[model samples]
Target: MAPFEPAALPELLPLFYRRLFPHGPYGRWLGYGGVVKNYFQLREFSFTLRDDIYVRFQSFSSPQELERELQKLNPYKIDIGAVYSHRPQEKELVFDIDMTDYDDVRMCCSSADICSKCWTLMTIAVRIIDRALVEDLGVRHRLWVYSGRRGVHCWVCDDVVRKWSPALRAAAVEYLTLVKGGAETVKKVNLSEPIHPFIRRSVGVVEKYFEAYALVGQDILGSPESWEKVLALVPEEHREVLQDEFPKKRDSMQRWELLKGRMERTRRQGTAGKSAPCYADWEIMLQFCFPRLDINVSKGLGHLLKSPFSVHPKTGRISVPLDLQRLEQFDPFAVPTISSLCEELDAAGDDAEQEEGGELEPKRRARGRRAWRPTCGSLSSLWRRWNVHGEESCGGGVTCKETSEASLPPTALFLLRGHCWPQASWCLGTRRLQPNPSAPLNPFPPFGPFLHKKH
Candidate 1:
């Protein structure tokens, strides 16, 4: 295969869309019941073409049309946008977050460069928001996708959420936002006596990572150069006192303790003074630790976000679905590029074909024999490859179709990269759906055939 570079996208995208895209599940997810006429058409698709030319308001009548168009344009990036009232200009509610916005707290990597140390910020963000979305709002069905770059985007697609009004969306954003104030304001987060339950919950999340993330990983107080940045968060005479005490401390851990002690003394001194903000040590930590969301993205109803499975042109990586259970261990660097995935599919196909040629017809028909396909592997083998627990790849907790947190491994994708593209079918469970024998031979009309549901 040619080097998987930006230059290779025009050549690679068509093959990926036509041969490798998981159309059956993808269509099933978007269509829901296919009851809402033009439900799929109501969706907005945006594409980033070569030379960074972006095209918007692109809608497809059917998943087949979407497949055909994708093959034709071979776009570099694809974004999913709000379902609209008329044209895509009139959009529905949506939310998005970027890691770049959290640059103030993240020290390991800046801008597009992200290491595992800073990656934990994203993990924290997802957990906090996922909990609130489920517990507070009573939402169901959310899809989380890796941004294919420096961050992650969560698509809150619960049936009621998509229909939420702009006012309700704005209220939701306001409820989630903390660490307010701009560059001019020294104190971003302020906590009063008896912090609110929402803030208390946030503090619980922050304390979990404070030492590993802030003190050790960032070493925010390791030097006069760095400690001053943190000291600035403190007010007046106390800042100078901590500055004097911090250097004597051996590491960030001890320095943080000193900082906490100072805050405690100030709190004891009381709210009698107007100048000092009645701030807890936890408030500063929350400011530094909490996920900084892109308020405008979630605030606007018309906002668009990058679609999952879209190839990030810069990295040559696809935006795959994230598996939440293994989020702490999720590494963006491991995701496969278009070229790599294709190469894997090709190699797996060669191996399967070789095995088929060598086997006798009787043996080939055995239940264990993997059915050969160009890209999609046999359903039986797919089930075996996805065996994470006693359960198949699919987990009960996830809202997305992914059976795991990581992208489809080449072993799984190549195991069942379907030959029929969008029409691919799999018998996911035990026992085939008995189509009336009197009915057409193709019980599953839209998908190719009735799958043998395994026990």
Candidate 2:
């Protein structure tokens, strides 16, 4: 494959939308099984064209029409907006985490640039936030997507989540956020007595990566300059002691031990200031490595977010859904670019023509034949899951249709009772509904209008 050139995006985008774009799945995801009258049509799409031209409030009558418009416009970047009439009722609960937020603590990269070492911060963010969403908030459906550049976007699509008010959304974000304040604040994280379980769990997630990420890869205490920043987070009483002790240590790990010892000894002796002494270490860990969120993105009802599968204008990388099952091994650099995918299709077409003993056809015609087809392995996997929503028969004259969160892994996407029913169908838009015998009983016991049971 030839090198990805941002300059050649105009030529490459047409071919990408023609051959590699997964229109069927993209349509199904946004359509939401026609949950409301004109739901898909009410939602807006914004397109950024060549020369920085941006078109907004573009809605479609159907997914088919949307695909045609995409092929025609060949947008440089696609941004999805909220449904016009739905207000806070229809939009997904979204969260944005950019690497730029970590500039203060990030040692390897800053701004738009990111490296594997710094990428660990993203992995940690996903793990910590995902756990809270699932275990704490009772969210069963969430889609995690790479931003195609330096961050990740999470869309929580559970029925309850979509109806969350702006205040509720803000509360959820507040629960997840720990590192606070701006560049001027010397101490970003402050803790009170008896830390919450959610925070304790977040600290546990950070602990696994803190040593490798902060102490070693970042070398947060390797030099006096960096160590001073670390000292600022601790109690004032212990700062001078650690300031002298850090230089004598050999590495970050040793320097970290010196700081920890000072704090622990101070807490035991009750010599610390009015601040909570016992929580100092946890505060420092969180202030350095916790997920830094753009709170407005999560709380606002009409915020425009870059659409998944949209080609980033600068990087040419597809904003693909992430498979969290293999999150640790995910490499941002390995993501396929539009230029690479187009070249791949060209190579595959040549091989096919050679095998058949026929002359190669024009690139447009060759690729056009594969339009709406999955071209690469990751994309193919995404397509298969998305295609599941089109209606797959579950035998016994019942067809299973995934209406929402179709991009989630099988275990998350399909779980009934305690077992993994691969062909499980959602309650929405199903013609035949046979109640699973082993399904857990509803705890509400069929009560009032607010807590009535499903018939």
Which candidate has the top score in TM-score?
Answer: 2
Distance from true position, residue 347, model 1, in Å? 1.3
Which lDDT values do the candidates have, in the order given? 0.63, 0.70
| Model 2 spans with C-alpha error above 4 angstroms | 86-89, 265-276, 358-455
Q: What is candidate 1's CA lDDT for residue 116?
A: 81
Residues 1-455 of candidate 1: C-alpha lDDT, one tens digit per residue: 32468777777777677666655455555665575667778888888888889999888888778877887888888887777657433343444667777777777777878888888788888777777776677765556667888888777755567677767888987888887987677678877766677777877877787889888888878888887778777766677778678768899899889878767666777767534544647767877877777777876766778877778889887776665545676777776678886776566566556656766455543422434352224322333332322122121221222222122334334224221111222221212212122322221112111111221
lDDT of model 2 at position 351 = 49
Per-prediction CA RMSD (Å): 8.6, 9.1
- Candidate 2: minimum summed lDDT over ten consecutive residues — where? 443-452
Q: For model 1, what is the alpha-carbon lDDT of residue 65?
A: 88
lDDT of candidate 2 over 1-455, digit per residue (tens): 35789999989998887766767656756776665678789888999998999998899999889989998999999998777774534678899999999998898888999999999999999999999998898886667778999999988866677778889999999989888889898788888756699998999999999999999999998998888778878777667777777778899999888777756665676645543456677888898889999999988888889987789888888786665655787778877788777776676555444534535455543443333222323333434443442222322323333322322222222211011121233222223323344444321111111111132
TM-score of each: 0.79, 0.79
